[model samples]
Target: MWAELKKGAAVAVWFMFLTLPIMVVKVNPIEQTVVWRWANLVWLGAAVFVLTVVGRYCSRHRTELSAFWPDAHPLLAHPQLKRFLLIVLALLATLFPLFFSSYQINIMTTALMYAVLGLGLNIVVGLAGLLDLGYVAFYAVGAYSYALLNYHFGLGFWAALPIGGLLAAIFGVLLGFPVLRLRGDYLAIVTLGFGEIIRLILENWNDFSFGPSGIAGIPRPGLFGLTLSVDDAIMYIYYLVLLLGLITIFVVNRLRDSRIGRAWIALREDEIACQAMGIDKTKTKLTAFALGASWAGMVGVLFAAKTTFVNPASFTFLESAIILSIVVLGGMGSTVGVVIGALVFILLPEYLRAFADYRMLLFGAIMVGVMVFRPQGIIGNPRRRSYPLPMAAADQEVGHE
Candidate 1:
């Protein structure tokens, strides 16, 4: 009886949230830029409400529900049903832009960049167990690398993409060499200092970077000599980001399961044990740093094109922290979890227009809450094997390992 009530309530809540897209009103344009869709806010609210109700209901009638019927749970012991639900979700994500506006598509682009960045950071913090607080420095390097190279050399935006990644990888090696012996707080502090140092240089070095004023008019990405700026530019960027995001997910997943990836996990689990087992800690660590930085670099190129500008403000310690939080909150080492976390973090605040001023406050609170209640993060583990597995197991299996 209680299970049925829970199910009814859950369905009701889902309907309410799903209706938000058609109900919520937006008064301010700025608020709309980063806010979540009405439907998403509704869904989030419904999820929270249903969870609370289910908790109370289960606490009160735990035995009654368990005894009333062995098969009372509709979603239980039915793997196919779960798979079907997941396929629906994947379909929704792929088709979301088809139904959204240009403005919403732009926001989605930013979210995709965050997703890519989160994936990159996962290598350093999640896989290698390195606390890098200055990851944004590399992001800056990539953006500026592309910005300077494209503007000065008259290179194509497409060409600048990999060049930026290469530049970031070089700096990643330089940073790794010096900080190889540092760990924990010491490593974090150094990385933090590194970010500050880069920002200061960008601010003061007017001749090269044009100082705090920023470099403007960076080119947009193109395909076969055709720029994505015409027609639905946001959609074009979205597909580009999606393709890159998928590739990154695949690469990370493969690496995590491969020999080098195993070495990274061993190092993350125990440096001493890794050393004893003859894993080249130094080389493995550097590879993680380089790969992590390379992703940031690639995203930087995308960002520069997206914004058509590059400045120190774009790559600050806060940006690094937010990216790191996505990795941590999504469940480090879990690609799907990180991607989901990125979506929520990027989209939730955009939808909360009434509480616009409290965006950062809520962000901090959510991070703290997740850390306290779900240390393994919302997805629940670094490895996908451990879970609160999604209702649709087969659909959930679509991404990287």
Candidate 2:
């Protein structure tokens, strides 16, 4: 016990020292003053100490505690309970805007957009085992598609929606062709470079992408050509995103159960084995890329319509990381888990504005904890099917044969 306490204290002290500059010292350049937030240091140290102790305890007894984990809870395993919870959640979502303020609705709309993006990336990374760090390029394609089309041709949201997705799908195919033979870290680096290249082109091409100032004042979605008030518009976008999220969930779920989806999973597990089984590797990979990119593009259109603006800065590597994190933090290949992960990741940060300065720190810590304790994610993917056999009968049949 004393050894554990000592270790925890050491960790707490190290963290406190590491965070000293950010959490303890505040310097005002204009006023030429430096203030010491010693209280923050104390709080940080205490919190870290407690967390360290708890983490150590959990690690030591992980096997014993496995049965008590959220995913393993007997109540959560009940089919009827699952249905009841899902129905209740649906009802709450439908009535959300009615009770919540527009600000909250807007936040939820953004979260839904990300949820869709996560689901799209799940198709590639989770199902097909493709590490696409340049996923945001497709998102940028979608947003910019809508923005540029509206700017140049007076195209509206509805028309640009499909166009954006189609354009992104083409881009996905283009990207897919080049990276067909790449895998692992090589694939990640190439995708990262691809994303940066897209951003650079947008930033440097002044004539084409408005030179980083970005095109603004893009109109929101219209309802029969009627203009809505700001609050009404927020609510409208929320519902639109809600509907889109539902559609994405349904499509992804179907894809998960399809032959192609199984092929993708097989490819993810063992590419050579998948080929041995007569699966067309090239076609399967390209399909995953194209489908994933299409969803990002569509959500990109939604993002632009909601924000009423588009710029190169908004679609960065950080955005890709966040989307990818959603997939990791939620169970990869689990649609419901991805949605829950998105809401927790996006909404918790918004509500915890008081800890704005420590946001990234907290995020990193939580990710580390999850990786260590729940590598399968907050809601790991459950086995969808099982084959049962009667061993005695099988043995008798074999004996008779």
Tell me the number of clashing residue pairs for each predicted model.
10, 0
Model 1 Cα lDDT, one tens digit per residue, 209-240: 89998999887787777645444666877888
Candidate 2: tens digits of C-alpha lDDT, residues 1-401: 89999999999999999999998999999999999999999999999999899988987886698867656457877999999998999999999999999999999999999999999999999889899999999999999999999999999999999999999999999999999999868999999999999999999999999968998999999999898999999999999999999999999999988999999988997899899999999999999999999999999998999999999999899899888888888977788889988998899889988876676676677667677657668777664223224775598469644
Report every candidate's CA lDDT. Answer: 0.82, 0.90
User: Which candidate number maximizes TM-score?
Assistant: 2
RMSD after Cα superposition, model 2: 6.2
Alpha carbon lDDT at 246, candidate 1: 88
Collision pairs in model 1: 17-42, 17-43, 21-39, 34-350, 35-350, 35-351, 36-350, 36-351, 82-391, 82-392
Error of 2 at 179 (Å): 1.2
After superposition, the stretches of candidate 1 with alpha carbons farther than 4 Å from their true spots are 1-90, 227-231, 382-401
